[model samples]
Target: MHAIVLVGGKATRLWPRTRWQPKALVKIGHYSILEIIIRRLRDCGFDRITLCIAHLGDMIKDEFGDGRHLGVAVDYCAEERPLGTAAPLHLVPDWTSPAVVMNGDILTTIDFADLHRQHTTSGNLLTVAFHKSLLHAGVGVLRVRDGRVQQIWEKPNVEWNINAGIYVADPRVRDHIPRSDAADMPGLINALLADGQQVTGYGFSGQWYDIGTPFRYQKAMKEFLTHPDRYLRPDAPSNGNGRRNEVALEPDGDRLSVADLSPWS
Candidate 1:
């Protein structure tokens, strides 16, 4: 199956590090986040991949030229201006078949083949990957009736199924996205739902991380170091070494500073 990876965001939240480069080039161990994502897609038998790039797109083009090294055919759709998440789908070339669309910064072990199969057979225009996330209240909560407290639950946990930034979209869904202006995925989904089009959510129970911020990046690094086998390819030499690979960071007294490690190292 074909796939479209969105790597266009400025990623301002990951400032300083992202100030100079796109988040797609952010390193996790010896591989950049984009490399890991491409490798994952290749492993799942996706032969055709297209990257929708805007910010610092030239760097990405220079890094993964033609995708030949990764054993997949790679193409690029360079947006002249920033197009939000789902709008870039309209830029994909010959995107007549059902395809996988996802964020470039996400690190997950989700099975893409299964998602493709489910979407194809279910007759839905769109199938979104979802994960259950817990929302914890910071302060105490109380149930009051007639100005009298009947029950009190402190720091309650609310379980919510959130969008996992991955989607299987039918070719027809592209019609919903405007040709001009920016559009996000949530807006697309809501439009589909409002029109009574079939939109399904596929829940996955696996390791998933959206490395959009420094905290999340560090957390993903730690998890990947702790359990490399779960995230790395079976043949990856670092999978079973049980060793912590050094990332591109060094101690700056009490703080940490970015180091100049080769992204492909």
Candidate 2:
């Protein structure tokens, strides 16, 4: 199956550092976030990947060019403007098969192949990997008989679930995205749910982090560095220069728009 990686965010929250590089290029441990994600996709037997890039897109293109060196065939679709998560799929051609889509800035150990297989077997139009979190919930106070405190129980935090930014989508779902504007992924999923289209959620209990802000970025970097074996690739050295040593197929500033220098072959 093909994979689509969203590599185009302004990354304003990661300012000063991302002011020059795309968030995907941000290094965690020895590998750039992009490299780690791509390696994971490859590890799960995925190739023929498509990178939907916007800001600093060329830099991403230059870095991963064709993907052959990394044991995959990489292609790119450049968006002139920021298209929300689900819209870029419309810009890619011929990936008619079910595809895996993910945010470029995430670090996760979830099994991509399993997620894809599950999506197909369940016969859902879309399936999202989800995680659960608990927030502090106040205890319940009960006033009984004559306004006397009858019961006081510590409030338990409510359980909340969220999408993990990993998705499996049918090509037909492209019909829901508009030709332009900030058409988003969540809205599309909501539309599918409302229409009774098959949409599923897969619970994943794995290491996952959204590396969009400086704090998260630092956290991811520290985690990977301290536990390198958990995330490092076989070919990657432990000395931690893998990111800097990576071959640049293209390099462009994320916030500053630049011309596409990718070789058309």
Candidate 3:
């Protein structure tokens, strides 16, 4: 499967930690967040990958120039301006296959190949992966009727099936995005709905973490050291020396632009 990993967020929520490097380049263990994600994708049978990058994109392009080092072919699409989440899809030249698009900061063990397989069979234009999460209301919430308070619940734990920031989209989905403005996946989903295209939600449980906040980042770091096996496959490709095999990039100079480089051939 050809996968597009969105790595271009400003990540203002991550602040100084991402001040110098894009969140995808932030290192949690022996590898950067993007590196581990790509490695996991490779393990799940994805061989062609493209990164949609912006903030500190040049560094990302330099670090994984051709993706050969990771046992897959890699290409890059740089967003000259922030394109939200889905707009960057327009920047890519073309990836004809049904593809899974993911947020750069997410670390998950979902089998992307399987996700694509399901998308093909569902007859849906879009299939989104969702994970359940509980959030505290923090303050008492009340039900009101005619200036009278119905029962009050204090700090309820709300259960929700949150978007995992991962999706399998048909190539034609891009046709819905206009080249003029920034668009996000949510907007794209809504557009698909308005156009009468079918969309689906795939819910599953797994070791998934969105390293968007410092607390979450710290938690991932701790959990990974304690249970690396949960996230990484023992059979995943690796160099005998105990690290991943990687390729060196050509000497860097000027910054890159949208669709400037590809490894499709």
RMSD of each: 12.2, 14.2, 14.3
- What ranges in model 1 sit over 4 Å off? 135-157, 234-265
Query: Which stretches in model 2 have alpha-carbon errors above 4 Å?
Result: 136-153, 233-265
lDDT: which candidate is best?
A: 1
- Report the C-alpha lDDT of model 1 over 1-265, residue by residue, as the tens digit: 8999999999999999998899999999988999989988888789999999999999999999999999999999988988899888888888888999999999877777778888887788998887644556566555565676664545555445557899999888878888878999999999898888868777665678999888999999887787766665633342122111123334232222212111222
Poorest 10 consecutive residues by lDDT, candidate 1: 238-247
Question: Largest TM-score belongs to which candidate?
Answer: 1
Each model's lDDT: 0.80, 0.74, 0.77
> TM-score of every model?
0.81, 0.80, 0.80
Q: Write the per-residue lDDT of candidate 3 for residues 1-265, one digit (tens) a residue.
A: 7899999988888888899989999987887889888888888788989999999999999999999988999998989998899999987767787888999888766666666777788888788887644455677655566676654556655545668899988888888887899999999999998999878777555567889999999888876776666557735322221111122223133222112222221
Error of 3 at 82 (Å): 0.6
lDDT of 1: 0.80
Assess candidate 2 and give its TM-score to the true structure. 0.80
Cα TM-score of candidate 1: 0.81
The collision pairs in model 1 are: none
Worst 10 residues of 2 by lDDT: 253-262
> What's the best-to-worst order under lDDT?
1, 3, 2
